[model samples]
Target: MLLALYAALGVVALPRLLSQVAWFERAPRLAIAMWQAACASVVVSALLAALAVAVPASVLGHGLADFFEACATLLSHGVPFTSASARIALLLAGVLVVRITYCAACVLLSARRERRRHAEMLAIVGRHDSRLGAMVVDYDECMAYCLPGRHGLPVITTGALRTLTSAQTAAVLAHEHAHLRGRHHLVLAAVRTLVRAFSGAPLFARASSEIARLVELLADDVAARGHPRVHIAAALVGLATGRVPDFALGAGGETALVRVRRLLDPVEPLRQRERLVGILTIGVLLAGPAAVAAMPGVRAFLAHYCESFIF
Candidate 1:
């Protein structure tokens, strides 16, 4: 029942609710964590629910030991599932497995190809900037972003260097550095993979966009540590029209205007109590599916213990 509710919420409620929440813009890190937790919880709960429905409660209630024995027996004896529910569950699980595997492969191959292409471009046209710890490109478009790899090179355009003030440039560098350090591109890639897998699912589509925005906000926050918020905002404005590479984490994107406004008119960080609540919520989101999945095993263990004591 809990799993059902989770699935429904993931499909129906979460996409709308998360997108409408304005406070998340102010608490980007917490928001990122929550989005990730939500995605993970949905997938895990769906898989667990399928397994729960496929395997008889009677067998599961006897604990992990009994559950495995039953599986072994079925495999050895070539017994077919008797219940219609079990057959449906098995079909759903198989479909999910194939979808997840294909999506993962697509994401990996795409990322690898893009990275190689960008790395080759960098080697050909990029110059080392020892002062800024980045690779300077001679493009006229104002741009600053990071190309993630083993060394994670920061790529800055000549136009950006010419346009931005010294402080603004520093802020942009810090922002890109934050993306590299946090490995935010990987997060975006995962969410994107899910979106690609479930193109029709609003939750995946919304999550992909939200997570992308949140990561930029997070990078902005990190950049704020060393530079004035105004400088970061200015840098964002200057680079707002710049085009980023497909595989790069850029200082500007679709949300550049909103981010500039956020930097200029900053909201107070979440209160400690609020942050604590958010953390607890994330914990519950992750742990709830696991608990539901394990309940039968837990019950079986306790029942066995009681029976042994009586014997």
Candidate 2:
């Protein structure tokens, strides 16, 4: 029963452990109540696990129980966030390091180039497609759309103008413009930044991929606003091509196969389930140490484990 409890506790905490890596990815859209319920479940499970561990089974249990109680208390005391040795502090510092590095790299390497590219793209608008546009550059294989200052940034490529029919161009323009108007870049950038922070974790990579898809789906949602499905589908097919260079205007990021179908068929919407999972996961992880402090049986279990090692 105690072993079973410990296992359950570990299972409950799994989502939380991954959430620090997941939430910053493509956060799902789900109900608040469900989110909180899952969080509570994780906490309760972890605490129960600790309780099981702390329960003594035999006559030699007293000293081991004492040791476990002490360890549990220390673990539950909450990490000394101000100290570098503290787990919470270390985690925070690691995230900050990633953020600063990302910011620095953007400022030094990508920002200026982006600015120059935006200006150039804007100037060449007349030579390309003219309506419903934003200059979302495909720099470094990452697709990003930018809204020009104040007025709508009508992004036009000479190729899109020549290759696509007027309606197709309009569809593409609407999609990109939706991205600019909607401030989609903020969400996308935030997810990527998080992905970089948790790069060591496998979940982070998966989150990054999901986030990229969600952003595109979000844009497609916008473009689909009062537009024909065929138009949107054609425009997507038009811009996203394998042969296109990363520096040019393109629309190929994540999950192209799925996205094309969604655009054509028009699903209800992207739900918040992913986001809910993410929040709950983080909650469990943050609560893990706290449970040890609160649960007596878990304290006993750990004490025995420690003493067994000693003996």
Each prediction's Cα RMSD? 3.5, 11.5
Cand. 2 TM to true fold: 0.49
lDDT of each: 0.85, 0.51
Best-matching candidate per lDDT: 1
lDDT of 1 by residue, 59-96 (tens): 77776688899999988997988988888998898898
Q: Give me candidate 1's TM-score against the actual structure.
A: 0.89
Count of backbone collisions within predicted model 1: 0
Off-target runs (Cα >4 Å) in candidate 1 are: 72-78, 241-254
